[model samples]
Target: MVRARMSPRVRQLALIGLLLAGIGLVVIGIIDPGAPAVADVQPPAQPGTAKLAPHLFEGPDGPETLPLDGAFIANVWLQGCQDCMPSFEAWKRLYEAGEIPKSLPIVNIAYGEVDPAWAERYALHDTLLVDSDGSKLVKPQAITTFTTLVVAADRKIVWRGLPRDPGYLDQLKSALAALPKD
Candidate 1:
C-alpha cells in the first residue's frame, strides 16, 4: 500500500471550501427553511386523478368540511410564505377580470392558524379556511409556497399546480368550463 497525504496548502483550501459551503447552506435554511430544493419538488398531481381528503376547516361562517359538494378551486398556502400574497393577488386579479367564473368558488386553505382578516386583505369574498384542527392535509401533497387544486364534484383533483405555471390559466379556465352548468 502506498501512503498519500495532501499538502498543507491543499488541505487548508479544502477546509475553507467546506466551511463556505456549510455557511451557504445555513443561510439558505434560515432564509426559507420550508422551501424544497428544485430537484426535490414533485410535479403537481395529474389532473382528475388525485383525491383530496375532506377535512374540517374553520371558515368565515363556521367550521366546515371542504370539497363542498361540487366543483371548486382550492388555493392551499402556508401562513408565512412570502410568495403566497402575490399568488393570492393574481387570483384576485383573475376573478376581478371576469376570467374566473362567479359560480366557481375559490377557497383559500391556510395550512396553519390564519386571521380572518386575510380575506379582507386579499379582497377575497369567497370562503377562507384555516387548518385549525391541524390535519395538515394539504401539506403532504403540496411542496411549494402555494398550490392550486381544481377539484371536481366527485372530490377528484381535476387540476393541480401553481397558478403561475405555464398554461395554468388556460387549464384552470378549461376545468371551470367543464363543470356541470347550473
Candidate 2:
C-alpha cells in the first residue's frame, strides 16, 4: 500500500488558507458587531450627567479626570497613528481662533501608550489622557478613528463628527456656542 502525500504546492496553499483565517478572526475580534451605524447621529444624553468612568482614563500612572460639566472636546487616538498628530494641530488652530472656550478643558485620549510630554506639547496645553479603557475592558462603542464627541452637561453626546468632519477646532466652536454664559 502506498500513502499519498500532499504535493509542495498543495501544502503551501493549505498554509495560506490557515493564515488568512487567523487574520479574519483578529479583525472580527477587534471590531464590534453591535455598534451603531455611522450614518446615524449620536443623541445627547440628558436629564442627568454621567461621568466617564475613571477606568476610561485609568492608567498605571493615575486615573485621568475630565470636567463633568460644560462642553468638551475629546480626541480619540491610537498611539501608532501618524495622522493623529493632526488632531493636536487642529486644537491649536481653534485656540488661536478663540473658537475654543478658555475655561473649558481639552481632553486627549490615546488608545495605547504614548509619550506624556509629547502628547502635552501636541495638545498645545490641553489635557492629555491615555485610554486605559483598553480592549481588555472597553467595548468599542461604534466610533470612527477621528471620532470626537461634544458631551453635554447631562453626560450625553450632544453632537458628533458627522454632517461634516468639522475636525477639532470647529467642534470646539460648536461646543462653546452650545454652552450657556453663566
Backbone Cα, N, C clashes tallied per candidate:
0, 2
Question: What is candidate 1's CA lDDT for residue 48?
Answer: 70
Clash pairs, model 1 backbone: none
Candidate 2 per-residue C-alpha lDDT over 1-182 given as tens digits, one digit per residue, 9 for 90 to 100: 99999999999999999999999877766785544445543543332243344344644467656656565656666554555556556655655667666665666666657777666554443566665444421234433454565665545555555312456455556666776554
Write one digit per residue (lDDT tens) for candidate 1, span 33-125: 865676765565677767777777777688777756788888777665787767777776776777776566778787767766766565454
Give the C-alpha miss distance for residue 6 in model 2, angstroms.
20
Compared with the true structure, all predictions reach lDDT values of 0.72, 0.56
Task: Give the poorly placed runs of model 1, Cα more than 4 Å off.
Answer: 32-43, 60-62, 132-135, 164-168, 180-182
Candidate 2's TM-score:
0.56
